[model samples]
Target: MWYQVFLWALFSSMFVHIIAALIAFCRLRKHKIGAAVAGLYRAADFEMMPFYALVWGVGQSIIVSFVSFTRILATL
Candidate 1:
């Protein structure tokens, strides 16, 4: 249960970060990023670490799968 709670908090933070990034990316056009906006961008960038861990920890296979999927979907 302890580990479960920990994972829950961890995943929550990760999800929040992803949501924040989407918001920042969406807002980047209209607003100039001052200190606070910069802070939000920085936070979204920092979220990559936890996001990577959460996703990669699921499995290497999934990571590879996703890379391919993203390339195909985004055509990037």
Candidate 2:
């Protein structure tokens, strides 16, 4: 059960990160040189990445746990 929770968190965080990167990349590609330079700086903005990942991971994990708990209760 704990392993399942861990995996859920891991996958959720990874998915969020991948989607964010793709979105950032797309935005960067769509812009002019100045915007592209700014985008490069944004892409290298590591300060918020970990916080975002942690928030998403924990949020997903909480949702998963709540759903599983309710399912267990229903089975009882």
Candidate 3:
């Protein structure tokens, strides 16, 4: 059933996008990694810290929110 679930178009697309974004966010940061990677801009300078804003303190929340919405719509 889990394998069958992975085959759906919606799941595949959203998962691909999520994975890509996560990779990108990781590449952009050096000191810490968290939900905020989504929001990082070129202007930002690296400042190593122990923690980050939770639940997408970075720009990632927007992408995650969109993906979540799509999942909800697909279930309907």
Candidate 4:
């Protein structure tokens, strides 16, 4: 039971991160932020330790995604 719960949580987090990364990339492309920054952000996301990623990464990713969402809505 405990193992199942852990696996579920892990799966959910991975899904969230994948979505967040997609949003971040879309935002970057829309703004033309340059390949260097885009590459750096990608590197950072991958290099981030799992523990810290689980704790703080979600918040950061969500914030970026939220800002992108609002910006898109604002233009319309």
Whichever of 2 and 4 has more TM-score, that candidate is 4
Candidate 2 residue-wise lDDT, 41-75, digit = tens: 68988455688879979999999999897896677
- Against the reference, the lDDT scores of all candidates come to 0.80, 0.86, 0.68, 0.84
Candidate 3, residue 39: how far the Cα is off, in Å: 13
Number of clashes recorded per candidate:
0, 0, 3, 0
- Give me the displacement of residue 41 in model 3, in angstroms: 8.2
Across 1-76, the per-residue lDDT of candidate 1 in tens digits comes to 9999999999999999999999987777667555576688687886556877777678888877988877876764
lDDT of 4 by residue, 1-76 (tens): 9999999999999999999999988877767557776588798886766887687878898988998978976777
Q: Which stretches of candidate 3 lie over 4 Å from their true place?
A: 1-7, 30-76
- Deviation in Å, model 4, residue 65 alpha carbon: 19
Query: Over the stretch 1-76, how does candidate 3's per-residue lDDT look in tens digits?
Result: 8777767977889999999999887766653643365346423765545365454365597887887978976777
Clashes in model 1: which pairs?
none
Question: How close is every model to the real structure, measured as TM-score?
Answer: 0.39, 0.41, 0.31, 0.42
Sort by TM-score, top down from the best: 4, 2, 1, 3
Best candidate, TM-score: 4
Error of 2 at 37 (Å): 4.3
Candidates, ranked, lDDT:
2, 4, 1, 3
